[model samples]
Target: MSDLKKEAESLHKAATALRKVSHHTIKPLHEFKAESDDLGALGKLGSLLGATEDIREGMHTLAKLTKQLDEEWQAEAKLMGDVSDAFDLLDILLAAAAQAKKG
Candidate 1:
């Protein structure tokens, strides 16, 4: 395979893997938010529910920014390596926030 083809395949695999990780990391937080809403409606765990909702919003914002970054990165391939790393960092942050809210 040509070097360009190899690189493209590698990048595609990496992106696919990262997308799986992103879904796993974010799914729980969304589930938590739903559960929290049900519990919060009774006036119990209101603060915790509120906090989870805020985190959910932040996650949504991060997801939007990540999409924007991905589009920009595709338009200008400069710093392509950093794009993956930045997304990994965002995934880590989202996972941490989700864990915190779960606890």
Candidate 2:
């Protein structure tokens, strides 16, 4: 249906935006970590880096899974609901990453 197509397009846009933001957000942290000499700070940065990578991977997987859904499944209300929930979580994770970058 047209509505489903619209939803898919919206999701695709969100995914693309998140990908771009996350890349910009993560790249500096990586460079800083590599340049830093403090061991304690490096350990903490390592953990944050790992978490950001996990979040990125999760977003990619969710997008792929959404794409894998057949047309009949995509039409189901539950499918959209589930995908929306996943996006919500991704948004939260991205917000946390952004906050961390700010701090």
Query: How big is the positional error of residue 3 in model 1, measured in Å on the Cα after superposition?
Result: 2.1
Off by over 4 Å in 1: 38-103
Question: For model 1, what is the error of residue 101's alpha carbon versus the real structure, in angstroms, after optimal superposition?
Answer: 62
lDDT of each: 0.57, 0.54
**Per-residue lDDT of model 1, residues 1-103, tens digit only:** 3344455556656655544554554576556545644544535464755665665566567666765755564444434445655655666676788899999
Against the true structure, whose TM-score is highest? 1
Instruction: Kindly report which residue stretches of model 2 are placed more than 4 angstroms away from their true locations once superposed.
Output: 38-103
Clashing residue pairs for model 1: none
Candidate 1 similarity to native, TM-score: 0.33
Q: Write the per-residue lDDT of candidate 2 for residues 1-103, one digit (tens) a residue.
A: 3344456557666544544444453565555444443334436665766764554555566544544443334355445555766666666676788899999
Superposed by TM-score, candidate 1 places the C-alpha of residue 52 at a distance from the truth, in angstroms, of 11
Note the residue pairs that clash in candidate 2: none
